[model samples]
Target: MEIRNAKETIRQGAPSDESSKPDHTTKMIVYMTIASTAAEGLTGICSVVSSFLNDFSME
Candidate 1:
């Protein structure tokens, strides 16, 4: 009886493991996209600040 219960648990766990793989991949992709977008925004802000400083120094 214990062996039968264990088998049932394993069978349930198997489908969850398979489903989690794609969910994990999707979460990783989303994180990467957010990181890249933040990097682009930071670079744009840095360039604008540098240009402004250059103009101020020239004056």
Candidate 2:
């Protein structure tokens, strides 16, 4: 009986551990995606501002 209970506990715990691993990975991917998007937006804004300044200086 005790061995059976132990086996059941291990089976349940294994799935929980596997599920948690994917949750962590998903969170990391979401964070990285947000960071990359923000970086791209900032770069685009900088480029536009630089072009505007260059045009202003030429006039």
Name the top TM-score candidate: 2
Reference-based lDDT, residue 8, model 2: 95
Q: TM-score for each prediction?
A: 0.57, 0.60
- The RMSD (Cα, Å) of candidate 1 is 4.7
Off by over 4 Å in 2: 1-17, 20-22
Candidate 2 structure quality by residue, lDDT tens digits, 1-59: 99999899998775565666645777899999999999999999999999999999999
Task: Looking at model 2, report the run of 10 residues with the lowest lDDT sum.
Answer: 14-23
Q: How accurate locally, in lDDT, is each candidate?
A: 0.89, 0.89
Worst 10 residues of 1 by lDDT: 14-23
